[model samples]
Target: MELQLALDLVNIPEGIALVKEVAPFIDIVEIGTPIVINEGLHAVKAMKEAFPHLKVLADLKIMDAGGYEVMKASEAGADIVTVLGASNDLTIKGCVDEAKKQGSKVLVDMINVKDIATRAKELDALGVDYICVHTGYDGQAAGQNPFEDLATIKSVVKNSKTAIAGGIKLETLPEAIKANPDLIIVGGGITGQDDKAGVASKIRDLITQG
Candidate 1:
């Protein structure tokens, strides 16, 4: 499994620093939606500069103009860009097509989708590279978890890559990893605390080799 550590809300300097510490350990570095919205594509570019070896993901949460968003994210140095699963089929398909032309991957994040199973199947048919079963940070604070949602989506979309995000901490990782998700995304659990490198190392050890 690939471990993606989400660095959200940290400024450019802090995000770069955290990546410097954790990039060697983790498989991907995510420039989260909040951070990207604050810093612009410059955030994604900066992350790519900080660690050229690690894959960069820009969580744009794109709801419209999928082609333009995918082009911008790819040019900004995002290997993978995300579009909301709640978006219309044409929009999602546009993003997927644009990503293909740009040689970048597209992830359809199922955050507030009414029918996750139905949407997962649609994304699978559209040739999306990844399906992210995510609960927003606000939802996390409200006691929502996508772990079970991950299982439900996984069952429906058996061929595509799967990822889980939100409220992922060290203690909760083992269970999430056991789900055998293709990627495990962590946001506040690592970036909101001290020892960013240590936290990443622990995640790397627990997920990939375990």
Candidate 2:
């Protein structure tokens, strides 16, 4: 399993600094939706420039014009770009095709998708690099999580790697690890902690032990 640190509420500089603390423990640094909204693709470029070794993911959650968006993100040095699972298949195809040409990757975010298993199967066939089961902040506030959704996608997704995100903390990480997602995304779980590097290091150790 790979650990991904999600930088949702931070700006480019803040994000860069945060990643530096836990860079050794993470495989990917995510420029989350809020940061992209606040800083544009510059956040991706900045993160990539700061940490050339770690992969940078631009969480665009793209709903349309996948090809163009992926191209722009790739040009901005994003290694992986996200597309909404709720989007049309053609849009996902566009993303996959463009990402391949750009030598980048497309991670389909199944955040609000009504039928995850079916969509995951479809996305896997459509050639997305990763299919992520995610519960957004509102869902997390309502006491929802991605653990069950992670299992749902894992059951049906055969071709693409699977990922899970939202509300994943040190206390609950072992439960997520039991499901065996290919990528485990943690935001406040590490970022909100008093000891960011310590928590991140532990998270990485748990994943490594698995």
Candidate 3:
């Protein structure tokens, strides 16, 4: 399993500094939806320029015009672009096709999707790179998580790699590892901690051990 550091609340510079601290432990540095909205694709480009070796994900949470959005994000140095699972099949296919052309990837975020298993199966068939079960901030506030949703997608998604995100912290890292997702996403889990590097390092160790 690979660990992804989600940078949602930080600015571009703050995000860069945070990544530098945990670079050794993270496989992907995500320019989260909020940062993307505030800084545009520039956040993706900045992160890529700062750390060329680590993957940069643009959390566009795209709801429409997938091909165009994915193309723009790819040009901005995003290695992976996200499209909502609730989107049309054509939109998802557009993202997959465009991402393939750009040598990038499409990660379908299954947040608020009513039927994760069925949608994951369809997205997998559409050749998405990753199917992620995510609980948004509001959901997380309501005490929701992606664990069960992760299992739902894991059962039927055959071709695509699986991922889980939403309020994942060091304490809960073991539970996420037990789910055996290809990618594990954490935001406040590491970012909110006092010793970011220490927490990230420990999380990485757990993932490696798992």
Query: Which portions of model 2 miss their true places by more than 4 Å?
Result: none
Lowest-sum lDDT 10-residue window in model 1: 187-196
Candidate 2 lDDT, 104-207, residue by residue in tens: 99999998899888889999999999999998999889988888888888888778999999889999999999999999999999999999999999999999
lDDT of 1 at 5: 83
What does candidate 1's lDDT look like per residue over 1-210, in tens digits? 998988888888988887787777888899988898898999999889878889999999989999999999999899999999999888898998999999999988899888888889988998899999898977878999888888988899857899999888988888898888899998777777689788888888888676
> Model 3: per-residue lDDT, tens digit, 1-210?
888999999899999999999999999999999999899999999999999999999999999999999999999999999999999999998999999999999999999999787888889999999999998999989999888888888899778999999999989989999999999999999999999999999999999999
> After best superposition, candidate 2 residue 130: deviation in angstroms?
0.4
- TM-score of structure candidate 1: 0.97
- Candidate 1's C-alpha runs over 4 A off are none
Go through the candidates in order and give each one's C-alpha lDDT.
Answer: 0.88, 0.94, 0.94
